[model samples]
Target: MIIAVVDGMGGGIGSQIVSSLRDELPSYVEIYALGTNSIATSAMMKSHANKGATGENAICVSSKKANVIIGPMSIVIPNSMMGEVTCRMSEAISDSEALKILLPLIPEDFELVGLENKPLILLIKDAVKLMKKEFNIK
Candidate 1:
């Protein structure tokens, strides 16, 4: 399956997600790193994504091809990621048929109530676990 990991603003989150997926999922699963910028894409590539792409066009195109889209909830929020995420990019991701596994992280202006505010590592682990469960992997 093709799993798209989207991120921006340093790609730290995307990199971690790629690394964890690489370690947990079977090698056959394709992990595509979709970044909002070159720096973010580079970071995820360093973490060993099967492929990487940058910018709105790349994201818009890749999202449609993915079986699952995983990223911070900000990915679907227009003008999030310090404005790196455009309205068109957000729309494309949101409109994609892929199942979305969004981390609750968001910009300061917004709030996701009732979440435990777990650390990033735990959040990523939970995401991977959910992916496995949803797809019935292993």
Candidate 2:
């Protein structure tokens, strides 16, 4: 299956996701790094994604192709990531057929309720577990 890891800004979150997925998921699964900028894409690529793409158009097209989409919740919010995420980029990801696994790692303004404050590593492990469960990966 193809999993898209999308991110913006410095791409630290996306890179972590890619690295963990590489270590946990089967070698057959494909990981696509989709970033709002080249810097973000490069960061994820360094984590060993099968492929990488950048900018709004790449994100829109890649989100459509992936079987799963993983990233910060900000990917679905227009004008997010300090204005790097555009309206079209958000819309494409939100509208994609892929199963979305979004991390609640946003600013105070977008804080989610009913979620315990967990470290990023813990949250990423949880996300990886969900992926394994959904994909029936051992």
TM-score of each: 0.98, 0.98
lDDT of 1 at 132: 97
Which sections of candidate 1 miss by over 4 Å?
none
Task: Compose the digit string of candidate 1's lDDT tens values, residues 1-138.
Answer: 999999999999999999999999999999999999999999999999999999999999999999999999999999999999999999999999999999999999998888998999999999999999999997
The C-alpha lDDT values of all candidates are: 0.97, 0.94
Clashing pairs in 2: none
Cand. 2 Cα-lDDT: 0.94
- lDDT per residue for candidate 2 within 12-117, as digits (tens), equals 9999999999999989999999999999999999999999999999999988999999999999999989999999999999999999999988855786889998
- The lowest-lDDT stretch of 10 consecutive residues in candidate 1 is 109-118
- Ten contiguous residues minimizing lDDT sum, candidate 2: 104-113
Task: State candidate 2's TM-score.
Answer: 0.98
